[model samples]
Target: MGMNAASVLNHIINGEPTTPCSSKGATSSQAKALTTTIINHLRLGRLGKAVSVLFSAPVPFPFALYVHLFRICASKKAIVEVRKVESHLVSFAPTPPVFLLNRAIEAYGKCGCLVDARELFDEMPQRDGGSWNAMVTAYSQNGYAGKALGVFSDMHKSGIFAAEVTFASVLASCASILALWLSRQVHALVFKYGFGGNVILGSSLVDVYGKCRRMGDARRMFDEIERPNAVTWNVIIRRYLEMGNGKESVFLFFKMISLNVRPLTFTVSNALVACSSFRGFREVIQIHGLIIKISYEEDEVVSCSLIDVYAKCGDLVCARTIFDLLSPKNLIHWTSMVSGYTLSGKTRLARELFDRMPERSIVSWNAMLAGYAHSSQWDEAMELIILICNDMRNTDRVTVSLILNVSAGLSDLELGKQVHGYMYRHGFYSDLSVANALLDMYGKCGNLRKARAWFYEMRHFRDMVSWNALLSSYARHRMSEEALVIFWEMQQEATPSKFTFATLLAVCANIFAREQGKQIHGFLIRNGYDLDIVIRGALVDMYSKCRCLDYALNVFIGTSVKDVVLWNSLMLGCYYNKQSEAILKLFELMKEDGVKPDSTTFQAVLLACISQGCVKLGGQYFNSLSQDYFIIPQVEHYESMIKLYGLHGFFDELEDFVEKMPFQPTAPMLARVFDSSKEYNNTRLGKWAVRHLSFLKD
Candidate 1:
């Protein structure tokens, strides 16, 4: 007979497994061959063919089959195929190996199937620290901080030693949750495992403690480690800044330099943030020097911070200089420069820079809008709002808030109405910030009723800033009763901020309502809030307005950290209360203590003299203002002098003074001279005023 197909295959299968002729059973060798074939097909990227071949085989290579399916499903993002392998595990009577279980968990985690990952973790017959760490890391990476910590706790109970990666992930988890207590426990465990000194682990711990606002603990851990790397020093510095200890942050930064530790780019960037946070230009310049030494001063992040510092410090020249020197100006750098110009009230310069940016983000648009708002260039601000609306990228919350502020500054009811329409159309009217902005705009635009409606609508979703903004709007519009009502309402849910009280106190001064003022004062004192300069200033102004000089004095005296502006406010308070003698006394006290009074102080003193009918004293103070303070008095000063002269019947002296003045008189000046001549009935002064007024009009 001819060689049959089976007979021929058997003759060739000399070293291979013999066929099951008598029994319908496959040998282990045949199974091995089948598994090898399926795994090879999977490795070749032919997953469909591998599945088909394995399923068609009389015997199954369960391990290889599961591995093949897992790889394909994980790679293809195919959830169904991945679940098939998981379901296959449930049907198997024999337990899968530990490596196989870990593989399944890893595949699930990498695929972002956290639920399956957790289920697999819990179902593990026996788990090592590696298994626990994997689950914890997955949970942490997926933003599940609580579960990550729970897994870590389980790892501890199981006595599975945490490796370096485990500590890193868990420490990061603690930082994310801001769980200081759990983080401390983890830190103790890290030290116990002798991984405390690891550079990466130590750095992570520093970050964790710093994020938890435990700057001292972060510093301690940093100091305990011998020869910390750049990352370690950076973490400690970042922590100091985050904790509002900019002064200490600068100290530690210098310490790092003394220790010959070179800071990374992030270090310089964070140091710049520290400067911005503290409003410390001195420290910013120091950071600049360090950055330049390290050849990172010109980096976009560093330059952006420098620009922000100079701008916020009202040093527009320096801000512009830094901005100009940047090699490739990015959106952040442009935003900082433009924002600086805006805050400093340099609208033209800000607009020029805004127009010059190569690309503008929503931040850049907001900066431009803010610049216009701050400079009181309302028309331009409104125009830009329209332009921002036309641009798709400018539809963000920041842009909306900025436009609202612009409308508020302009007090343009028409423009504000347009913005409100835009806000409603964009579905941003429901956002509390947008709503607050609208309320503030309406209040500023003399639409207090509209502002009230918006405020009432926002009651269901109350945030501190929104409430404060509404109160401030009421204060600004002299709606004292409404402002007080909002203040009382805010107290029911949110804690009243310094700003809320400050606005309420401002309302008190506007209406000169002593009863309301005292109520706020009592609340401030009871809450230990009287020591705040802002609150004290408002209180002083309020009491002074109500003619309660003793109360104003007490508030001023109670302030421990009085800013120069606060002291000036107190002096003005005295003047407002008709206590000219007290004003002079305060002025002398301010100068004697080396407070270095500015031009405003001199002007206030002159006004006090005029109010007291001390003409000669006013003249002496005015002359001193020009000579000593170098304050070239404007028309307002000259008008005050004319009023002083008319009151004392010193027309001859006024005429002589007017003749000696260098500047051509403004219309207001001529009007003042004309009015004074009418009172004194001086023909010569009257003729001079007519000529000057005609010239001014011409």
Candidate 2:
């Protein structure tokens, strides 16, 4: 057979004429022999020889020979070979049968030759469902998701008979685009086309739902997939992890294990991540053991993930141990270790390691830069930025943003301007995130004119963060009217987020504009903001500052999860309104409700005590600072205590309290003692205060 392959090619393809049996071309013994030899060479892994013998055929090759050639080239993803076969096939048959042309289209698509695939498909006199499927699959697999969807639209208009593969490719496109609404519609079409029971197609449906965040629907589709494979299990588990349901994600991981399904390495990485987010050290330890048992500990991707989760769990020792064991020490492991050290504030050692890296990616450079930025090593960070700008490799937006952060930290408007120029020169200013960072840097570094210039320059590209950055800048400068006008303009374009409303309320609070505060609060509620703890605390603080104590208290009472901030806000409101008795009662309620008191909480409590002249009660609460709650008394707490004793005419106790305090009495404390001495006619204590104040400046 091998000899025949060599001999058959020399007869026809080597400048020898083919024997034409009829208009249908050769069907004689010679053509059959040529086709056989070509298949034999292809089967023997001699693709070059097969093509040689194919072109050297003594007659026009049969259609079946071309089918085999297309199938082989497609399987290997051999774009060069597919192109050769295509040119030869087209030169002979300008209008081949649709099925044969369809095969050629599919071969091109599989090789990621989308342009060639589309060209071949367009020139076809007719197309079946396979032709459309081939084009969609080409775009879908090449990550041209929008293009795939566009071609699928054309497919629908052509009224071609769609096949199972066509829907499958289209479904994949929807998944890539995260078009959840469209995914649901395609899912309905799946059942209507009677492909509901096909497990492969069913898994695609599951993947679509999972990536789109419909975990419940993803799980249901997964369960219906008979004999669910590794991919099926991975889809739901990863989605749950993405949704931040770490417990459920880990639970699914265990369930998959119990069913005797071996988790893929990808699945193990996600499970390790979930363990970091919600589980304990022991669970991560178990995953480490599983990795060793499965022999995946050496896999770089899984190893990197284990290192990240270990670092996140505050076990950098173990993370470093795993990082050291990797043989090749690729960029990922290097970046992960540097990031881990930077996060843990071991910047000196991180820099040492970063300096020794064999190679560097943008992420590696960013990790090092971030370490310097986080540790506030301004000299090293600034120097590194200069080095990065001079390097041959390109720095991405993250690098530029971190550099901007360093400039903002130093409040160096000159350095920031240089970076802005770098951005404009390199074309990164077009990216919205890069533009947003520049705007924030300008605002922070005291270059408001430049900030607004860049902001208005990118008006067409502004997202919510863009508007918020500008609004926050105005708020920071106390440009109340300007901020209000910006907010109104923002409402016409983008919906206000919780942060947006919070900034507006802060603006109102600063000016004590009660009406504007109420208007913002109304807009906040009307827009259905979730009123998370941050927003709720902001609202309470705003209302209280606006002198609406009743409204502030209403916000406090309506909240089900009253954190310490809420209690403190209400208590401070009471102190502001001179509701000393109510402040005392709320303090008791806060303790009873098990809300631990911080320094701010006790300040409000002590201030209320001083207002009411309750010296003994104030003393007991002061003792509770170290006794029960372990909160160290700040200077304000000591000042409040002196006022409490002095206003109530307790002269001797005031003198003793000041003398036995952990430190020497502040001038303010001694002065309060002097006032109480004059009011109560205690000349002896007045003399003692005068002695202390003789040399101490108030």
Best by lDDT: 2
Give the TM-scores of the predictions, in the order they appear.
0.78, 0.78
Candidate 2 residues 1-698, lDDT tens each?
Answer: 46764564444333223332335423455666776687668758988788777665535666666776888799999888888777777666555678878888888888888889989888887777877888888889889998988888888787766778888888899998899988888788778878888877888888888888888899899888878778778878888888999888888888888888899999999999999887467888988998898899989879999888988888889999998889988999999999988888888888888988898888998998999998989889999888887773788889988988899888998988888899989999898888898898888877778888888998898999988998888888888778889999998989888899888888888888899999888877787779887788888888888889999988888898999988998888887777878988998899899888898988898888888888898999888998988888999888988888889987777777888799988788888889889899999998988889986863
Q: Which ranges in model 1 have alpha carbons more than 4 Å from their true place?
A: 1-97, 100-104, 119-127, 153-162, 188-202, 276-286, 310-326, 557-563, 581-589, 596-600, 612-638, 652-679, 683-698
Superposed Cα deviation of residue 617, candidate 2 (Å): 9.5
The alpha-carbon lDDT assigned to residue 150 of candidate 1 equals: 90
What is residue 514's positional error in candidate 2, in angstroms?
A: 1.9
- Model number with the top TM-score: 1
Query: What are the per-residue Cα lDDT tens digits for candidate 1 across 1-698?
Result: 23553343233233233322223345555755766676566557676666566455554344534654676677776665566566655444256667667767767876888999988888878887778878988888878899889988988887788899999999999999899998888888888888867888888888998898877788788877888999888889888887787777777877888898888787777777766766778877777777787888677777777787777776788888877787777788878888888888888888887888888888788878877877778799878877886875547877777777886777668877987898888888888778777877887788878877877878788589878877887777677887888788888889987888788777888888899889877887798864577778888888888889898888788777677677788888878877777778888888777777776777678777777778888888889876887777766677777777766778887777777777766687777778878777877888889987887777
Query: How many clashes in candidate 1?
Result: 0
Segments in model 2 whose C-alpha atoms lie over 4 Å from true places = 1-81, 92-103, 125-132, 144-163, 178-189, 212-216, 276-286, 325-328, 344-358, 371-380, 390-392, 578-592, 602-698
